[model samples]
Target: MATKDADKKDTVLATAKERFEYALSRESENLERMKEDIRFAASSPDDPWQWDEATRKERKNNRPMLTINKLPQHIRQVTNDIRQNRPSIKYRPADDKADVETAEILMGLARHIEAHSDADVAYDTAADHQVTSGLGYIRVIADYISDESFDQDIYIKRVKNPFRVHMDPDIIDPAGSDAKWCFIDEDLKEDEFKAQYPDADPIDWQYASDAEWYPGDKQVRVVEYFEIVEKKTTLCLWANGETSFKDEERPESVMAVEKPLKERSVMKCECRWRKLNGQQILEGGDDGKVFPSRFIPVARVVGNEYEVDGKNYISGIVRNAKDSQRMYNIAQTAIVERVMQAPKSPWVAPAEAIEGYEKVWQTANTANHSFLPFNHKDEAGEPIPAPNRTAPATVETGLAQIAASASDDIKAETGQYDASLGQKSNETSGKAIMARQREGDNATYHYVDNLGRAVRHIGRIILDMIPAIYDTKRVARILGEDGEAANAILDPDHPEAFTEVRDENNEIKRIFNPNIGLYDVYTTTGPSYSTRRVEATEAMTAIAQGNPEMWQVAGDLMVKSMDWPGAEELAKRMRLMLPPQIQAEISKDEGGQPEQPQIPPEMQQRMMQVAEQMETMGNELQETKSDLQKAQQKAWQEEGKRIKAEIDADKANALLAIEKAQDSAAAANPAAGQGDVQEMVNQAVAMALANLMQQREPEPMPEPEPPMEMPQPEQPPMDGGMPMPESEVPQ
Candidate 1:
C-alpha cells in the first residue's frame, strides 16, 4: 500500500510541474510587458527617464532636463480616498431576504477580516496601482494556528509577487469558471523552498560545494496553480455518516452500505516546483501541495483599464499624466536653457581703435559696475558707440504658455483639478466648487467602482469559507446593532443552530442555519451609504428635539453612526437618563406593557391628604366605640335598680291583699269559717308568692347613648363682635 501511495504522489507532482511550465510559457511575454509598463510609470531613482548612459551624457550638453514625477501623487490621492471610505463587510439575506444568523456570521467574519487584513490589503492595493503594471492580489488562507486567541486562523495576506500573476484570459468567473490561475514566486531561498515540502528530498544546491550561500544563487522557484480537476466524490450513506456525524466516539444512529458515486469536477491547488530558479531540472516530491479550497487564495483586482485591442490591463492614472508631465518637463528645460545662453550685459568696440581688450573684458566680468580705460581711437582715431541687447520677452511668454498648457492637460487627463485639492479656484461659490469637484470625482469613479468590486469579491471568498471556518460549535463574539459585543454559538453542525434568541413576544427567534442555503454578500457603497447614517441621525435628532418622544431611539441611532470611543456605552447611559415613563414605554413587551412610574406633584399631594383623612376617621371611630360601651353599661345598672324597687312594692301589695282576704273569712262564719280562713290565708300566701315572682321579672337592656361629635375649632367674629356659627368654622 505504501509503495502504491508513493507512486501516486510522484504522478501528482509530475503533473503539477508540467502545468506550472505551461502557465509560465503562456504568460511569459505578458509578464515582461507588464514589467516594462511599471518601469515607465514609476521610473528608477538611478535613471528617472530610463535613458541610457550615453543619451544622458548627450542631453547634458543640449538642454536642462527635469523629471517631474506626478505618478506617485496620483496614486496616493486615489488610495487616500479609498482609505477614507473603506468598505466593511455586511451579510445580507439570500435573495434579499433577511437572515440574522447569516448576518451575524458575516459580521463576525467581516470584523475578523477587517481587523487582520485591511491594512495589508490597502497597502498592497495602493502598491499594485502605484507600480502601474501588476494587478494586486490578496491571498486569503485558513489554517489552525495554536497561538491564535480565538482559535480562528484565517489569514488575508498581501504576498509580494515576484512575477506578474496570470489567469485564463477568456474566463471571467474567478472561482466557478474552468480557468487555470497560478501565482508564481521565483528565486525562493533553499530554506524557504524546503519549508513547503519538508517531507521531500533535500535540494541539491548547484553552487554549494565550494562557496557560502549567496542571495539569488542556488534558488528554487515555487508555483501554486489552481485548476478544475475531476474526482470521484462519494455521496453514499457511509460517506455521509463519516462526514456529517457529529460524534466520532460513537457509531452513527443510521447505517447503510457504501455505494458507487458519480464523478464531479472541483477546483484544487497543484503546487509545482523547479530547481535552480525555473531550471530544466525538476524536484522529486510526494504529490503536489493541494488544499480543500474551492478557489485559490490569490484574489485579482483588475484596475480601470479600457480594453482597446483585447488587452484588458493598462497603466492607471500615471499613464494619463505621463505625456503632459513630459511636455511640462521639456518646456521647463527650454526656459532654463534659454536663460543660460542670454547675456546679462552687452559691449561693443571698434576693432581698429580697440586697445587692452582682454583687460576691459576682465573688468566688465569681475565688477558689478566698472569703467574700462581704453583709448577710443582707431588707426584713423574714430569713435564707435556700444549697444546693449534687450532681454528676449518671447522667452518668458513661451515658458508661461507652455507651463499653463501642460498644467491644464494634466488636470484634464487625471481629473485632479484645483477644487479636488481644496485649493481656491475661479469658481466663486462653494456650491460651484463642490460641483466641480464632483465632476472630477465622477471622471475617476471607474477606479473606485473597480475597487468596490474587488472588495465584494473578497467578501464572496469569506462567505465561501464560512462553512469551514464555523465547522464546529464555537462561541463567537458578535457585534450588535448598538455596537455592543455579545457571545453567540456558531454551530454549522446542527439544524436549529443560533435558536437561543427570542422576540418581544417571548417566542423563539432563530437566525437561519448556514448549513442550509447560501447567503448573498453585498457591499454598502456611494454617498447614500457613506453619509446616510449621519443624515438619519441628524433627522432623528431634529424630530426628537420638539417631540421628545423619539429621544432614546434617535440617540441609539446616533451612537451607532458616531465614530467615537465608548459610543455604545454612552448611548446606554443616555437611555438611562430618559424619563421613567418614556423608559417604561420603550422597554415594554409586545403583550405586556410596563407601568409608568412617574406621578405629578399635585396628584401626590392630593393622595397624601386623602390618606390623612382616612387616619383621622379611624381614630374617631375607636373613641366612639369606647364611649358607646360605657353608656350601655351605665344604662344597664340603672334598669337593674328600677326592677328591684318594683319587686319590693309588689311584695307589700300582696301582703295587704292576703290580710283582707283572711278577715272576710272570719266575719262569714265563726266556727265553720276558721278552716276557711286558714285555707284562704294559704291561698293568699301562694298568690303573694306568685305576685312577687311576677314583679321580679328581668328588664330589657337600655339603649346606648349617641356618641359625642368632635367640636369644631372657633373662628374670629365677623364685623360686629358676634360669635361665629359652627358651619362657618374651619374643620
Candidate 2:
C-alpha cells in the first residue's frame, strides 16, 4: 500500500511537470511570431542581416538618410487621445430600480478600487503600448500581506507589463479577457525567493548571475502559469423531517438522516510552476491545484477584433506610410537640398585673360570671402564678366508638392487633420468645425472602442473579485452628487441589520442596510466619453448662461465634465450657491422613492415649537374676538331700548297735543261741525309727526311699530252727545 501511494504521488508530480513543459514549448513558437510584431511596432523594422554596419559602409551615400518616420507619431497621437479621455468605470444596479444602498455600495467599492489601485497610470501605459505593438497586455492579481494587523487580507493590483508577458497567441481581450493558459516568467534574486518562501529549500537551486538581468549574483527564473482543471465536489443533502419524510416515518431512532452525496464537476485553477536554475528545476514545487480561476489573471488587449488567422494582426499607422515617408525623404534630400549643387555660368574668355581662375573657383565653392581672385586682363584687354545662373523653378515646386502630398497622405491614413488637431483652418462656422471633428472621430473610433472594451473588461474583473475580497465590512468613499465625497460601508456578506442609512444632512433614517456587491459594471461612452470635454463644456456653458434655468438643472454636470482647471472647486461652489431650502431638491436623485426631507433634529424641534406657539396665539385671538362681538351686541341692544323709550314718549306727547288742539279748536270755533273739526285735527297731527321725523336722527333699523295710537276724541258716538269723556272714549 505504501509503494502504491508513492507511485500515485510521483504520477501527479510528473503530470504537472509535463503540462508545464508542454505549455512552454507551445508558447515558444508563439513568442517568435510576437517578436516580429513587437519589432515592427517599435518602429525598428530593419532586417538585421541585410542592413548591418558592413552594408552601410559599402553604400557611400553623401546625403544623410531622411526617413520621415511618422508611424510612431500617429500611434502616439491616438494613444494619447485615449489616455487623455480616460473612461471612468461606472457602476449601476442590474435592475434600474434596485435598492439605492446596494447601488451606492457598489459605486463606493468602485471608487475605492480606483483610488487604491494604480489603474489609471496602468491604463495609459497599456493603451499606448498596445497601439504601438499591435497587442497590449495587463494583469490583475490579488495580493495579501501579513504583519501586525489583518491576515490574508486581499487587495487588487493592475499590472501593466506588455513586454515580458506570454499568453495564448489566439486570445484578444485585455479587459476582462480570458485565456486557456498564461505564463509570467521573470528572473529574481536568490534573496527574493528566500524572502517570499522562507519554508522552502533555498540552497537547492543553482545560481547564474551573468545570463539574467536581475540585480543579484544568484539569479533564478520564476515560471508561474495558470491552467484550467476540473475538480469533483460532493453535493450534500441534509434531511428535514417535515419535507423528506412522512409524519409516521419521522426519524425516532436517530436525530437526522444523511442521504447519499451527489457528485458534481467544478472548474478550478491548477496553478503550478517551478523555479529553474538554468536547465534544472529547484527542490520545491507547487503540488496542489488552486481552485476556481474563473479568469486568467493576464489580460490581452488587441488593436482590432479577435483575428482567427494570425496574418490579420493590426499593424501600426505607419505601415501604409512607409512608401510616403520614403517619397518624402527623396523629395527632401534630392530636391529640397539640391541648391548646394547649383550650376554656375562659365565665362568664356581668351586663355590670356584667364589667370588665377582655379583659386577663384575654389573660393566660390568653399569660402564666404569679401573678394574673389580673377584675371585682371585678357589677351584682347577687354574685361570678361562672371555670369550667374538660376536654379530651375520646377525643383522647388516639386519639393513643395511632394512634401504637401506626404502630409496629406499622413493625415488621411491616421485620421489626424488640421481640424482634429485644433490647428487653424478655413472652417468659418462652428458647425463646420464640428462636422470635420466628427469625421476625424469616426475614422479613429476603433481605437477608442477597443480601449473602452478593455476598460469594461477590467471593470468586470474587479467586480468579480469584489464580493470575495471585500466579504467583510469596509468604509469606502464615493464621489457623490455635486462632486462631494460620501462614505458607505462595503460589506456584501453582512445582513441588512447592520446598515445605517443617513439623509443628505447626515441624519440617520430608521431603516438601514449594508447590502453591497449586487451590481453591473459599465464603461463610460458616447461623444461625452471622448477627450473633447473642454469644447463641450464651453458650448454647454454658453447655452447654460443663455438659459439660467438650464444651468440650475445641469450646472453640476457641466462642472464635472468640464475637465478644466478648478472644475471640482467650481462644482462645489456652484452647489453651495443654491438656497438651503432647495438644495435638497436639486440634489434629489431620480431613482428610488425620494428620501423624506432630511430636516435637522434641532430645526425640526424648533419648527414644532413654533407651530405650537402659533396655535396658542390663534386660540387667544379667537377668544378675544368672541368677547368683543358679544360686548358690541349688548351695547346695541341697550341703545335700541333707549331709542324705543324715547320714541314712546314722543308719540305720547304728540297724541296729547292732538287731543288738546282738537278741544281748543272746538271751544274757539263753536259753530264748526264735528266732521270738519276731526279732519282738521288729523291733518295738524300728521304735519307735526312729519316735522318730528325730519328733526330726529335715523335709527340703525326702523324703530319697533309705536304701540300708542291717537285717542278718539269722544268720537261723537252714535248718540251724538257733546263728545264723550276723554277717559271713556276708547277705554
Candidate 3:
C-alpha cells in the first residue's frame, strides 16, 4: 500500500509538472507582449517612454529625454467613465423551474455578495489593468466567513498582477470563460513556505534550478492550479420530469422515488483545484476539492482580442498609442535641445572692438550693465561699426509641427479627443459636443464591454456556488436595485424551496430562494442611482419649465427626483397638497396608498356643515320610521283583540243552539241520559270556537322600507379657494 501511494503521488506530480510546462511554453509570447504593454502604460520612472537601454545610454550624457506621457490621460478617461457607470450582475430565468422572483432574489444576493466582498474594487482594478495592459483577471473563491464559523461565503477576489496568472493557450473565448485550465502562481520566502506547509518538503532549489519563475534560492513557487476533469456518470430523468446526476448526493425521499423514466450515459465536467509545485502536489492530491461550478473560477477581461495566422493576440488602448507617445516625447525633446543649444545674445564684432570692455561684454548676457565702451577705430585708424548683439535662434517650425502631429496621433490612436477629455473643442452645440464624446466612447467601448463579460462570468460562478455554499436554512442579506439592503430566508429543504412574500393585494411580490432553479446570468452597465436621479431631476425641471402647468400636477415627482437632503420629505409634503385624483393616479403608479388631499380651511368648514345637515336629515327620517312602526304594531294588536271577541260570541251562540237541540232530543227519546246531552253541547262549543279562530287569522307585518340614500355633498375644489381649470381637472 505504501509503495502504491508513493507511485500515485509521483504520477500526480509528473502530470502537474507536464501541464504547467505546457501552459508556460504555450503562453510565453503572449505573456511577454502583455508585460511590455504594461511597462509602456505604467510610465514608471524605470521605463519612462519605454526607451531602449541603448538609446537611453546614448542620451544619458546631455540629451533631453523628456517623457510627456499622454497615454494615462486617455486611459483614465475610459476607466473613470466605467467607474461612473458601473456594470451590475443580473439574472434571468432560463427554465420552467426558475421564476422571476427567484431570479430577482439571486440578483439581490449577488449584489449583496459583491458589496460584502468589495467586488467594485476588484472590478475597477481589472478594468484599469485591462485598459492598461490588454489583460486583467478576477477569480471567485469560497472562504469561511469568520474564524469561528464553519460556514463558507463566496467572494470575488482581484488579481492585482495579471502576469501571475497563466491560462490555457487554446482558449477561444475572448473572456477566457472557456478555458479548461489555469494557474495562479505565487512566490513565498523559504521561512514563510515552511510556516505555511510545515509537513511538506519544500521544492529543492538546486534540483529545479532550470525551471522558470520557480525554485529560487530565497523563494519557492506555489501554484493554485485549476483544471476541468471529466467523468462518466448516469443521469436519471425521474418520473416527475426532474433530473439528477447519480454522483450527486440525494435525500432518501428522492432515492425512494428514483424510478427513472429514462437513463442516459453522459460525461460530466467538474472543476478541481490544487496547490502544487514542480516537485509535488503540496495541498490537493487525491483529496483535492472540487469547485461547485463546472467552469474554472478565474475570469479574464481582455481588450481588443483578435487572431493573426491562427495565433491569438490581445491588445489594449495603450498598444497602438505607444508609438505615438514615443514620437511625441522625442519631438518635444528635440525642440528643447534645439532651444538650449542656441547662443544667448552673443555680440557680433571684431575682437579689437571690445579690447578694454572684456568684462563688460562678458557680463552683458548675465547682468544689466549701464554702459560698455568699445573701440570705434582699429589700430590702422580705420572707423569700425559698434558691436551689435545677435538675436537668439528660434525653434524650427518643422519640429513644432511634428510635436503637434504626434500629439494628435496619440489622441487618434487612443480614440480620446479634446471633448472626451473635458477640453473645450470647436463644437458649438451641446448635441455636437455630446456626439463627438460619444464617438470616443464607442471607440473604447470594447474595453468596458469586455469587463462586463468578465463580470457576467463572475456572476455565473457565484450563482453556481450559491446553492452549495448556502445550503443550510439561514437568513442572507440582499440588496435591491436602489441598494436598499434587506434579509432573505434561504431554505433549501422546504417542499416549495421558496418563501412567497405577498404585497398588500396578497400577490406574490418576491420569492426568496437561492438554492433552487437554473438561472442565466447577465450584466448591465448604466448610470448609477445617484447619476440617474440627477438626470431625472434635470429632465423634470426642463419639462416643468416648458409647461408650467406640469408643476401643479407633478411637482412632487420633480422634487422627489432631486438628491439633496430633505428632498424626500419635501416631496412627501407636496404630494399631500396635490389634487385627490392626481394623488390617486400617482399612488397607483407607485403601488402605494394615496395620501389624503389637503383641504382648505373654508372647504373643511363646508364639509362639516354638510355632515351636520346630513345627520339632521337622517335623525328626522329615523323618527318618522319609528312612528310608522308603532302605528302598525298598535293596529295589529287591536285587530287581534276583535278576532278574539268574535270567537267568544260564536262559541256562546253555538252552545245555546246545541242546548236546545239536546232538549228536543231528550223529549223525543225519554230514555236519553242527561250526561250525554251535556257532552254533545260541549262538543258543539269547541267546533264553533275552532271555526271562528281559523276564519279570523291575523296577517303578518310588512318589512320596513330600506332607509333612503343620503344625498352626497358636492366636493369642494382642491386648489385652495380657486376652481381648477378645465384642462387641469381629471377627466
* Best candidate according to lDDT: 3
Candidate no. 2 TM-score:
0.61
lDDT for 652 in candidate 1 is 81
Q: Predict model 2's lDDT versus the native.
A: 0.57
Can you list the residue pairs that collide in candidate 1? none
TM-score to true structure, per model: 0.66, 0.61, 0.82
Show the colliding residue pairs in model 3.
none
User: lDDT per model, in order?
Assistant: 0.58, 0.57, 0.81
Candidate 1: give its CA RMSD in angstroms.
12.1
Q: Where is model 3 more than 4 Å wrong at Cα? A: 44-47, 204-217, 249-258, 345-391, 501-511, 543-558, 570-637, 648-731
Taking the tens digit of each residue's C-alpha lDDT, what string does model 2 give over 1-731?
A: 97986675556445545655665564564445455544544543243211235544653366333445555666777777776676666666664334656665555556556555666676777777566545566666665534664523223354455545656544544453656656566666778877876654433222323443334485556655565444444333234321222222433323545452333344433433334333333433334334223666555556643344553344445445555655655566557345645543233444543365666654554667676556665668877665333543345686878877987786887777778877768897999998998888788777677777777776766666665555565555565423356666555544442356667976653222333224677777543233366677888889988898876656776887776689879987766544444555654642233333334455455445555655666666668767767776788789889998989988898998799879877887889999988888898789878878888876675334333332322222221113334354232
- Decreasing TM-score order of the candidates: 3, 1, 2
Q: Give per-residue CA lDDT, model 1, range 51-163, as digits (tens).
A: 44564687865655666655656566666676656555567666433366667766765665556555446544644553365355556666664665545546666656635
Can you write out model 3's per-residue Cα lDDT over 1-731, one digit (the tens) per residue?
98998888777666666777787777678788878888787775456647777888998877778777788889899999999988899999887777786788888899899989999899999998899878899999999999999889999898999888888878877777788888898877878888988986677322443454444476877888788888999998876667788878654456664577788999898898888865667777754678888889999998877788887777888889888888888888889987986756588888899888898888877787788789999989998889997777788999989999999998899888899998999998999999999999999999889999999999988988888899887878889887889777777775554556666875444336665567898999998888898888999999988999897788889998897899989998887878778888887775567767767776677667666776888778779888978887888789779778876877687677677767665776677678876676677657656776677665666566565665655565666665434354222
